[model samples]
Each structure stands twice: as C-alpha cells, then as structure tokens.
Target chain A: MSSHSLATRTEKTEPAPARTRRTRNRGWKPRLAPLSILRLLILFGFGIFCLVPLIWLLLTPTKTDAAILGDFPLSFGTFDRLAAAWQHLTAYSGGILFKWMLNSVYYSAGSLVITIVTGLLAGYAMATMRFPGRKTILTLTLLSMVMPATVTVLPLFLEINAVGLTNTAASVILPASFFPFGVYLAFVYFSTSVPKELLEAARLDGCSEFRAFISVVLPIAKPLIGLLAFFSFVANWNNYFLPYVMLSDQDAYNLPVGLGALMAGSPALHPERGGSFLPITRPEVALAGLIVVIPIALLFLIFQRYLVRGILSGSVKS
Target chain B: MTTSRRAAARSSATAWAFTAPYALLLLAFGVAPAVYAIYESFTSAKNPGSLGLDSYAMVLHDFRFWPAIGNVALFMVIWIPVMVCGTILLALLLHERVGRLSSTMRLIFFLPGAVTGSAAVLLWYFMLDPQVSPFAPALHAMGLHNSIDVFTSSHLAPIFALVAFITGVGQWIVVMFGALQGIPEELIESAKLDGAGPFGTALLIKLPLIRKYVIYMMILAFAAALQIFVEPSLFYSITQSGSAWWSLNQLGFAFAFGQGDFAQAATVSVILLVLSAAAALFLVFRTDFFKTEVES
Candidate 1:
C-alpha cells in the first residue's frame, strides 16, 4: 500500500522544477551529509556490540581451549584443531550430538505442518463462516495467545505424563503444534486481506467447503501460509524449556536439550558414559553450539521477508 | 429465501468442521492445563491429607519468594527504560537511509536475533569471566581481577540486566525499525525543507509519531523482564549463586524442576498469568483489536 503511494509521489515530485533547485541549493556536503561522525560511530558501536560475541562463537571452535583463552578473540585457529573438536564432539556418547540434531529436525518439521494446517483452517473458518461458537473461539484464542507460553509447563508435563506420552516425540511435537499465535495471525490476515465476496462466489458456484478452500482460497493465500509457517517453525526450533521439562531420556533430547547437556556439568556429557579417554572440551561444545545455530540462521536468510512481516504484524495490533 | 437459509446453516456446520482440530487442541492443552494448575496450587501434594491453600501459603512465605520478586522488580526498572530509549534511537538511526551502508548495518544489528539463546549466554558467560575473557586486558587495566570482583552481590543485578540488554534489544530494534518505516516520508522531507536537522526530526517529529509503539514496547518489555530466566539459570549452574539473583521464573523453575515442588511452582505460574491477563485486558480495551473481528 505504501509502496504504491510512494511511487505516485515520486512521479509527481521528480518533474517539479522546485525539486532540482532545492537539491542544488544545498551546498558543501560532509562525509555523510545526513549524519555526523558521532552519530555514525554510535550506530557502529551498537553494531559491534551485537556482532562481537557471534564472531567469537564462530572463531572459538577453530581453536584449542588454551588458545581460546589466550589468542585474539577474532583470530582463526588451524584446521587441524577444528577437525579435532569435531572428532571429539562426534565421539562423545557415540555421536549423540547428531542424534539430537535429527530429533530437532523431526520435532520442528512435524509441528510446522500441523501449525500451518490448523491455523489456516481455524483462521479461515473464523473469518468467513457464521457459526454458533465462533465468538467464543475467537475470544479464547486472543486470551490464550496473550498468556505466557511457559506458564503452563508444569501442568502440561503432568498432563502429558498422566497419559503416558512423556519421553516420546509426541511429548514435544504435539503440544508445540498448537500455535494460538499463528491462529490469531491467520485470522487477522484473512479478515484484512481476503475479500468476502471472493469466497462467497465460490460457495454460490456450488463448491464444497473443503474444495473451496483447496481450489480458491489456498491459491490466493500463499503469503499468509508462508508467514504462519515461518513463525511456528522458528518457535518450535528454538524451543528449549518445554522439551527440557518433558523429555528426560538423554538419548531422546532435542538439539537444545542435548547441546545444553553437552555443556552442562552433568554426567550425560561425562567421559565415564562411553569409557572414552577424550572428554568433551570447550571447542567441542562451541562447535556443537554452531551446529545447533546454522539451520536457523539459514532459515532466516531464506524466508526473511515473510518472517519480518510476521513479526511486525504484532506491532500494528498493539 | 427459506431454502437459502438452510444452505447458510449447512455452511456454518462446515465451518465448525474446519475449526474442530484447533478447538480440540485449545481445550486439551490450553484450558485444561490452566485449570489444573489453578486447582493444583490450592491443594497439597497429590494424594496428601486434604485440599487447602497450604501450597499458596508455603510459596508466599518461602524465603525465596519475596527476594525473587524484589530482584525482578529491580530488573524491570532498569530493563524497561533501556528497551524503550535504545530501540527508539537505534531504529531512528536505521530509518535514515544513510547510503547503501545502512542496510549492512541493519543486518549486522539484526543478526544477534538469529543467534540461539544458549550460544548468546555461553558467549556472555565467557565474556564476563575475568581470567580468560576477551575483555581481560581492559579488565586488568581496571584492576578487577576476577568474575567474583565483577559480579559481586551489589553488581550482579546490573550484570544480569546488561546481558538481557545485549540479547533482548535486537528483536525490539527490528520491531521498532518496522514501526519507524511506517511514518510518512513526506514528514521527513518537509522537516528538511523547514531547516530541521536529523536529530530534530527524530526527536520532535518521528518520536511523537511512534508514541503508541513506545508505550507498547514498555508494556511488552515489562512482561518479558518479569519472566527473566535463561541468563541467570545458566550463570547459576556454574557460579552456584543463582539464589542471590533469583528472577521470578528462575525461582519458580527451580522449585518446579529442581526441587519437584509442583504446587508452589503452579502458584508462581498463576501469579504470572493474572498479571499477564491484566495487561492483555488493558490492550484489548485500549486498542480495538477485538472490535475488528466483530466488524468484519
């Protein structure tokens, strides 16, 4: 909407005689005409604050423990040390680090499919259909959406365990799949973007409810689907607390839980577990940390537009 | 018309069909667990003598409760202002399209949000360690010999708050950056025509335009700060001083997971829900977010 308006304004202003004269009259530009050196420095300073640690995270894995302590924080270590860290990380607990990464993939992918499907169905139903309990459904969705997610962890653990689902992937994937936030996002998105007449036309043409959603609505709703999918996937992937509470089997732990264990002073990462002489070291844990981080960074790099829109959508409502 | 009315009823049934899966989930996970948590908070340990407010009484009187509340209270005071002012300043700077370099700076600033929480905490854990930290040389210059000297009882609060600032600020920057982008360019251009400098435009014009988001950020930041856990939790694992800087969620998490005291844990969760519910209610009434559903 703003882009179209902006294009029109540029069209109108570029041909005006005053536009050129105004630019020509402004004389003597500094290094950055719009900003002073101090302002540029402040922004750069904040940029460095955000970046320095991540640079260290990347570089630390290349070095030995002593070198991590002694060398320049941003300097590279030998490829030999990097290979050794990977070897040690893989050797620990028969390469459970890879197992955790696989488990994370399973949990996040499963939950992503469920979240998108349920959110779209519910959101579309709420937006287009007249039903008896629709208001109550919408109200509860809003209320629960605003409630802090971690608030129910203890009771959810009890609920999951009472039914004998704990320690299974079901424990993590099922609960994480119910994305109230995504449901709300879809509901709001459909209400604002999709015209009522479009769907009504499909109904009047004798299309079945499911057929209409598949044939008519889904084609026009690609962006919304992408947005909801990205949001829920990121949330499920970054999930640490719930899985930490639910899954106790060391072998079943997802990436966050397993990486946390690898870092923990606990017995799981202990050398005694495998009778291996090589204990997990700083570089190994750092490498494992980088492994846990890469997929998410790639996901963000790929689907950044929808992800940014999904996040900023909250700002508008608030 | 009578036949068309029947068609409407049939379609409404179809709508219910579409909503069934999510509705079932909402009941099973959201409603049931919340009700159970409330019930459990008032009872004794399962299969105990009788039901009473014993858990609530115990949690309220626990030595950890008041101090944890005070600690998070102190955190809220520090975190909220930094979140508000810092996000505004950083976002305003980014909104100014200062050549092609601004885009690179934006990505650099935003990359931290992509970094995992565990990694960020691990980095800070080492960053604050005096002996092996990257800041060690500067720390030596200052004559602070160790983590203990730096994270002493009096200094622990700011240290925790600072870690939060470093990690938490990026997401808000991204949000406020989006908010700033919504302001019309004409205003900035007109301000330039009126001889307003960048600072004046940001302070006077742009700031007033995004006042709604400023308040929104304050409320949301307060909610986030109240639930502070990960940084302190990780720190405590190594330092054994988790109790000294017990944020509310950390304290409750310890009681729940560490000690296996579910009733006290549920009480803390319930208190958080009530507080969050009040904030949610305020938002619903203040903005017409709910009204849009009815109108549509």
Candidate 2:
C-alpha cells in the first residue's frame, strides 16, 4: 500500500523536472525562481532576530553595570571589565560561584552517565526481549513523561530530606537519571530502526542476548545514545526547580540557582542585602551563562550530523 | 514436570533480576513518595499529633488554591495553541526552503534551547523591564508601558505565560522541523504538482502525517506548562510582591521550604501528581501515541 502511494507520488513529481527542462530549452525563466531569493532573505532576517539576544549575552560581560545600561545594546564595553567581572564573580562570596559551576558539572554529568546506561539497557530490553509486562512497562514510562517534574518536586524533596540526601548532589542527579523521555526515544529508535531478524541470526550463532546487544545493537544505537546523552546533560545542567528546592547551601548550588542568587543579591541592584553577593557581577553572570551554554553548543557542533539523523529517524519511526 | 518447574523458576528469577533495580527505584522514589503525599493530603495538620481528611478540605476550600489553578489554566489556554501552531508553521517554512540560510535559521532558533533557565528568564526580564530593555519604546507605543511591573498582577499571568511560550519555541520548533523533514519529499512534491499551494499542501498532506507528533508535543507542552516555576518564580522573587499569583507547585514549594509547612506542601504536591498522572495515562493508553505494533 505504501509503495503504491510512493509510485503515484513519483509520477506526479516527475512533471516538474520536465517543465523546468522545457523552460530552459526556450530560454525562459520561471516566475517562482525569484521566490527562492525571497525565502533566503526572510530566513536570514529571522536568523538575526534569533541570534541577537545570544550575542547580547556574550557582549554583556565586557561592560560594567553602569555601562551595560548606558551603552548601545550590541556594543562591547572595555575589555578590563571582563577581568574585573571574573574576579568579582569568583571572589564575591568567597569563591562560591566557582563552587556552583563545579556542582553543576558534577550533578549534570553524573546524572547523564546513569540516564544513558539505564535508558539504553531498558530501551534495548524493550526492543529485544519479549518478556511479560513489556507493554505495561513501556506504557508506564510514557505516562511518566506527562507528569510534571514540579509536581514530583515537593514529594521528592520530602523523600530526599527524609533519607538525609537533601543539599547533596544525589538530590539532583538521582531524580534526573530516571527520565522517561530518554527511555521512550531509545525504545522508538530500537523498535523501528533496529532489525530483529539480525538479532535472531546472532542468537543462532551461539550469541547470548546480552552479547548480541553489546556487539550488534550498541553500535547501531550509537547515534541515538549520543543524542540522548547530549539532551540529558543539557536538561540536567539547566534544571532549576529540582536543585532549587533540594539544595539550600550556596556551595551546593548549581549554575541556574547560583545565577538566580547572584541576580537577587547583587549589591548595586538590591542595596538592602549589603554589597555581599556571589563574587559574580552582571557581566560575569552573562559570562557564566555563556560558560554553561558552551559545552552543549560544542556538543551540537560536533554531533550535528548524528544529531540531525537521530532526530529525523526517531520522528519518522514514531 | 520437574524440568518444566525448573524452567519456570529460572525465568521468574531472570525477570526479577532484570526488573529489580527499576522497581526498587520506582518504589523508593516514585511510588512511595506519591502515595505518602496522597495520604498526607487527606490528613489534617492543625494539631501535630492528629492527622485525618481535614487538610484536603482546607486546600480545596482555600480561596487561593482555585485561583492558582485558574492561573495555570489560563496559561495553558494561551500557551498550547500558540506553541503548536507557531512551531508547525516555522517547521514547514524551514522544510520547504532548504539551503545554507535555512540550516543557519534552524540553528539560530535552536540556540535559545541552549540557554539555561536562569539566563533565559534573566534575558527576558531585561527585555521586559521598561528602564533597561531596548524594546521598551516599542512596548510603550503598544501601550504596555508598565510591562515589567505586570508580573505583580494575577491578570498579567498570561503575559508571563506568553514570554515562557516565546522562549520555549526554539526546542519545539526543532522537534517539529525534524518531523517535517521526515515526510517523504515525494509526497510534498506531488501535492505541489497537483496545484496545491504551500499552505494547502501543508494543511492537507504534511500536517495529517505529522498529527501524532503534534499531539505528543502538545501533551508534553501541557505537562511542562503546569510546571511553570522558574519564570514566574523569578518574576515573583525579583518583584517580591506577586506571591498571590503563585501556581500550586510554587505554593507547595514555598510551604515546604519557604514557610516550613511540610504537610501542606505534601498535600499540594499530591494533588498535582494525581492530575499529571491522569493526564499521562490518558495519553499513553487512550491514544495510539506509543504504539510500535505497525513498525514490524
């Protein structure tokens, strides 16, 4: 049925090539050809619109508090302010900002490792093992995706506190490790894209299920696993509420919560709190924001091909 | 009979081995806390020693509780359709016009998703603040002169909701664009040749094929919208006067940690969990969302 539809589609699209050829033969230009230029212009305009704020974030760090509000939106302030901002940011609360950045790294990266391993295993199991309650498990995971993390936060906070894990990295990393979306993505990728007959063939060759998954399925699932890791890292890194409610110690604060504290406690802005805040300044806050985003941007740049392929294939199969 | 019994025992052991870790985690973290919260919701908190169904009555009967739900409901009313329609449109545009420019455009849109919640909220705060934002003149021209201060009112929750929607569009657009690109190119070309305009073809062919994805995105958005914390919370903390506009989740957080009312907080969390779980179940079982049967 799909092939018949494909054939008809091909027949309909074939006339377009012939028409273009005929127009070229007559030395005639198609009217719609100029629309491509229009499309490019519109896309470029929108691209600039999207990128300006990010550029503003990058430029904001070089300026002083006064200069940021005074200077043109895109203008770079003196370079010295960058150093000053850095020094102030690091030293503001006795080097707590750096501690927050490290905490962010520990929590996000820690969570990413567990999520990728368990998600891959669960996904592989769902794809390869025809066990009882497979459908039930998959359905439950999907349902979990729709439950708001905020709703779980209060309960989770109480649970973690009761276990004496509050204000610890486990508070953040443990919850993030169980992401159902990653499991679902992996499940869909495995079921639709990975071939089952190949696994059966491997089984006949005396390969155990675990061995076959490691040797065959793992290699095929690399793109998806990479995609999942990048996303999980980014999500955990950017996570605000979980860490906010879980940890109260400034030393335990992740970048988002730390930045929030900095903004709230900035002496210039809120004089009532005294001048003591995170050693970070506004531009330093901007710099720190840039710092947090850099790893994910690098990941996107490095894995662009795999990421796009993973997304496209995953979507279609779903 | 002995062999069959041994095999049954072996299989059961394997099942337990395979499932034990997840089950333990789920029970310890997921199910137990949720169930406890539900129990807490029904119990009274007036006396430290006594616990019965009074907390639920107090929470449900409270004037603030209903408005908090109303604030979130209003947020969803504006947020869901705009995000769904806007993302689909952006995706269609990107898919139809493929080139260096389009790819660059795609990356540009996706960049916002890279911004951590703090930065996104901070940037939007600066943009919406009348004194600091470059867009202030334009906002004033549109009669939104006190735009930044709007966060204080319950009426302006929708505006705060709108900012959240705009900031979040980048990721959803990427998801929708991925789905759009997956539609066999031939299907689109055929529709074009049949004298279908771009909009017409998108509405009839591409949209229908991608309807499931659209629904999934909506469900995800709806779930996330209910969790609107960082934006509204930041706005409230910064302004320090919008406590009345707190969503149930925010209120719960405040009760537990901020106000030191653990029991009340647990009660609120329980209600949110039940509602979200119901929504999740509907999507999973009632809809054909996660079905992989046709693939094989």
Candidate 3:
C-alpha cells in the first residue's frame, strides 16, 4: 500500500515538468478544474449525519433532566448540571464509577500488551519459519477470527467460573488477549510486508531465527504492531457482554457493564427500583456512556492514520 | 555440520516450545469449554449436575427456541442488505471525492465505529428514545408519539435491529471505502474516457470489482448480527414485563442464565456457533474470499 502511494508521489513530481512542456508546445493554458466536488458534498453531509448522535451526547451532559427532555436536542442547558451529573455519577453507589474506569484500563492495557507480544511472536513464526503444522495453525487461527466473541462468551464464562476467576480482572483480560484476528493481521502483515530474503540473509550471517526476527523483522513490523495494539486495546475496552455476565461484583465492572448497571438501576427505566433520580437517572446513564466513548475517541483522533491503515491492511485480503 | 542429528534434536526440543502455550490455552479456554458445553447440552442436572441429552431436549422442546431462531432470521433478513448497500454507497462516495474536507468527512464517518459496542448501543438508545431525541418532533409529525411504545412485541425486534444496523454502518463504510480506494484509477478514467457516465462507471467498473468485498461484508455482518445482545438486553430494562423476552433470543438467554439453566444457555450458544460457523465456512471455502495473488 505504501509502495502504491510512493508511485503516485513520483508520478506527481515527474508530471510537473511534463505539464510545463505541454503548455509551451501547445501555446495554450490548461484549465484548473477542482475535482471531487460532488464527493466532498456527499461526504460532508454524511459526516454531519454520523456526528449528530455524538454531538447530542456531548450537549446532553450540560442539561438537567427536564432540560434534557424538554429543551432543544443540540443546545446546552446549564454548565452547573454537567458538573452535577458527573458528581452524581461518581458518588452514586459509593463511587463505583472510579473502580469501573480502573477496571477498564486494567483490562484493556493488560490484554493489549499480551495480544501484541503473542501476536508478534506467533505471526513472526508463521511468516518466517517453515514449521510442521504451520498451515494447520494458520487455518485454525482464521476460523477463530471469524467466530463471534458473543457465541463463545457463554462457554468462556463457564470456564472462568469453573476456575474460580469469574469476578476477577483476569476473566476479561485473559480471553481478550487471545484475539485471533490480531494474530492473523500480524501474520498477513509479516508475510506480505516484510521481505523473506532479508530474514534468510540475517540467518546466514549467523543470527538465530529468534535473533533474525528481533533485529531484522521487528523493525519492519513496528507499524503493524502499533496498529494491532490499538485495535486490541479498543476491542478490550469496548467489550461488554463478557464482563457483564462474568463479573457480578459492581466494583469489578468495566465502563460498559457499569453503564448497563446504571441503566438497570435507573428508576424511570426500572419500576422495581421505584422510578427516582436519587440513585441513578437517564442523564447519568448518558454521562456514563459519554465517559465510556471519550478515551476511544481520543485515541482515534491521535492515531487516525494508523487505525485506518491497520483495518484496511487486516481485512482487505478477505 | 551434520544436518540430520541437529534437525532431530531441534525438532524434539522445539516441538513443545512452539506448540505448548497455544495448545494449552486453546484447550483450556477454547476446546475444553466447547466440548463441555456440548456434553452439558445433552444432560440435565443442578449446579453439580448429572450428564445426559435432556437439556438439549428441554431447550428444543421449549417454545422459545424456535422463535429465537425466527427472530434472528428476521434480523438477518433486515440487517444484511442495509449494511451492505449503505456501506457500498458511502464507500463509493468517499472514494470519488478527494479533498481536505473529504478526508475529514471520512474521519467523522469512521468515528462511531471507533466507539465500541456498549457506547454505540447507549448512544442509539438515547437517539431513539422519544423523550430525549431531536427526532421526537419528526416522529410525532409522523403520528408516532411514544418512541418506547414502538418497542412493542410486533415492532420491538425490528426497531432495535435497525438501530443496531445504523450504529454499525461506520465500520462497514470504512471497510467498503478501503476496497473502493484499491480499485485502479486508470480503470475508472478509461471508463470515463469511453463516454461512460458516473452511474455507468459505478455499475460496470466499480461494483463488479468490489463484489468480493460486498460478500465479505455480508458474511461478517451476518456473523456479528447472529450474536445480538446489548440492544435487547438494554430493552429488557425498559420493558420490565416478563414478556420482554418476547423475542426467541431474549427468551433463550433469559432461560439459560437468568433462570439458571446452563445446559439450555449452552444449547442456544451451540446453535449460534453453528450458524456463525456455517457463514464463515461458506466465505472461506465457497468463495475466493481470502485468496491473494502473488504480486509480480
């Protein structure tokens, strides 16, 4: 993909001289028409359409319950209400929100580290080493990649329960670290992006397979590794049902599960909870939801280029 | 420099080193639980339960099982086309237009996808709720006053399913855009030079090239949709009625986990597994989905 862009760059650079020559020979000026006008219009319209909900989410925190329901959807209600909502959400249930955020960070960071390391090692082996049953391993990894995490969540929960680790951080993090998709992404990246002759030359120069992988292949695989880490982190952070079912203790809940619990505890939503805003409310649920999305949105803004490349590179083949 | 002795020694030593961790983890988390679930599916017992196929029988015999299947079938029928068509259209739009604004537009369209499952669901829940949404007036104009009322037995599954589709379009759009960007510009230019209009170029040149990607998107969408959870689970909180589990899926999950019937939950999971695996296998073997040509 980079090579394709490089070719385009060279073409653009070379075309500058040719354009001047053509104009001189023809003794005429060329029209400088702007391309992509229609595309830009459509994309801009779609971008606003896509952002409406998020904009609404951001504006929502500022409103009291009445203002949230009665006022304009996009307008801010009061700055005080935003702080009030945050305070209420944090103080609700003995400040369980902090615990949930910590749990999310632990789960996402722990799994991300393991996934990147394992994916790199496993992907490097598959790409470079001609091991027995390597094909079988690749096929199994692909199959696992396509299997929905939800389908396996039940069995996995039970397994974790059997091991007496259901409510612990490990239950979520351990399963999340074994992302088959990341492994396959790394494998394809290493195979296609990294040249094989480089590794062979390094091996012939007395580097062991492991050393060759570390020194020669690792540098090339760095961009892909970063991409995989980000993907893994986002996936683990956003995970819901696994932790929802596995962790019963409120203190162990991650943001998604915590938000769900807030919804469940909302009095207007749940009649059993006696429909009051003393404990939790719709605005608090909204606030929690906003908090859950903020980190991911921040990460995306920071690494937008790599995220796009990672996803395209990972799935374009299939 | 004796190769045979070195090869034998290396093979023996490295065999465990290479396969041990993956094999152990796979068995402990993947294979063992799957086998145990299947085994438990056939049996009926308490927490420290007995072994047999009664659980499967009970699950199949339950009135909810078939209905859940029907609900998922209905969801797939509605979901797959919307996702595929919307993604393709959005991707085409992004690829045709190249500018700074277009780049920013692509980023915006891609933002919702970056937000994970729970956040998207919650966002949509608020968006769809009649009380808080900007769309309330429009819905009211259309004579639908109560948004939550739309989640009746008849419309509940479909509405939530549509919500799921809308929230998920971001990722699909990104995927389709990537495929669109890969089409050689020369092909498009030549088609234009041949007097083919934009619609004709899209139909003849672009759509055909990205047909594999469309199928890929469909299979993936189907697999993901098969395991619909958060929306319905959230809906349960609003609807409080026992019949909230009106959808076969909600009923299955409610029976298995909510009602302490692990065997039945395992059965439902197994059924989901089969459907997803079938879709996956169809993509892998029946199509050239993953086959890559060697770049010359």
DockQ of each: 0.48, 0.43, 0.44
Off by over 4 Å in 3: A1-42, A268-279, B8-20, B46-52, B241-252, B292-296
Q: Higher-TM-score candidate among 1 and 2?
A: 1
Better of 2 and 3 by DockQ: 3
Give the chain B TM-score achieved by candidate 3: 0.86
Arranged by DockQ, best first: 1, 3, 2
2 versus 3: better lDDT goes to: 3
Better of 1 and 2 by DockQ: 1
Worst window of 10 by summed lDDT in candidate 1 chain A:
A2-11
lDDT-sorted candidate list, best first: 1, 3, 2
**For residue B272, what is the lDDT in candidate 1?**
76
In the range A285-308, model 2's lDDT, one tens digit per residue, is 677667777777677667665445
Top DockQ hit: 1
lDDT of 1 by residue, B1-296 (tens): 99999988887889999999999888888888888878877876654767788888888898888998888888778777776788888888766543345546666766766655565566666677675576777777877787677655555567777777776676677667666666676887799789876678889898998887777677666666676676566656555555623877776677777777877778887787678767766655575545565344
Judging by TM-score, tell me the better candidate of 2 and 3: 3
The predicted structure with the larger lDDT, 1 or 2, is 1
TM-score of each: 0.89, 0.87, 0.88
